[model samples]
Target: MNEKTNRIGILPIGKVPEIVPQSIAAHISGCLDLPAIILPSLKNIAGCYNENRFQYDVGKTLQTLESIKFKDIDKIIGVSTVDLYIPIFAYVFGEAKQGGKAAVVSLYRLEKDTHGKKQPSSIVLERAAKVMLHELGHLYNLFHCADEHCLMHFSGGLQDLDASPLYFCRYCSKYFLDARSKS
Candidate 1:
């Protein structure tokens, strides 16, 4: 899809800070050249909490996100403050299905460093934007990059996430462009 046809929606899930989704929307327009709008906040994350892990399941959260309908939105990125995890991974900054219409990003881990130090507001915002865009890449069918500098690189923890850039590598950039074109 061309820039005109691809409109992204940022849906704040649960109790997310207002600025968080605003930042993601700004980054989507400034970095990706796509129109992005913040949708109304949804206070739902109820059925996704896992009793065993004490963390929200990414698959279930995403399933919940996919169930929501937003008119005129081609894709959606759900932002939340809760911790999210997949069955295989201990935690994830964000999660998405390949080429799917919806994705989710969690701010629980991004607020602190690997050493558990609280980060500055700027740092937290930057990390949040990076994860948002990275998951959006997956929504467009872009995979994890071998290049560590790319935003598409899998960030297993805070340290790795800090080291990765906020933009894609050259090859991944080309792939992202192609993916957007075909979407």
Candidate 2:
């Protein structure tokens, strides 16, 4: 594989509106300075909930992925809501085939406000961007960072998500550049 030939394909799974995927893809491409292409959504990819109704369905996710043409892509990034399950991650890895390079950025709405109110913060947009960049970093083989302010930090909740910076730390930046070199 000539490193220069790597391409990142952004697929919008399920019934998400077209604009949503395009917006997310643009942000990721801007952050990484890479070309991002949005793939058509696959039918039969309806969102589902678990037995506990926790919101997840691996089977449908895998089926959707199998329907796509992944031949030309060196990496794939899926953009969807938190309703998506961990199995979606499994599907990505399974398709990526260990070192094949693929990842998914599942967007979750922040459940709180800065003042502790139940209201969603206007910062949710920023949070979404951070999540997109963070996952893209993983696709490039970057890991969690010790810098709590960096985008690569593990954000468990709304507070942690708001606390993390939108920009990557120095080490993460270097890793991103190295990945770009391979592409």
Task: Give residue 177's lDDT in candidate 2 (0 to 100).
Answer: 86
- Predicted structure with the largest lDDT when compared to the true one: 1
TM-score of each: 0.95, 0.72
lDDT of 2 by residue, 80-154 (tens): 654555553422211122233555555444434645566543455566667667777766777778899788887
Instruction: State each candidate's clash count.
Output: 2, 0
The lDDT of each candidate is 0.90, 0.61
Tens-digit per-residue lDDT, 24-85, candidate 1: 99999888888999999988898999999999999988888889888888898999999899
Clash list (residue pairs), candidate 1: 1-180, 1-181
Worst 10 residues of 1 by lDDT: 1-10
Choose the strongest candidate by TM-score: 1
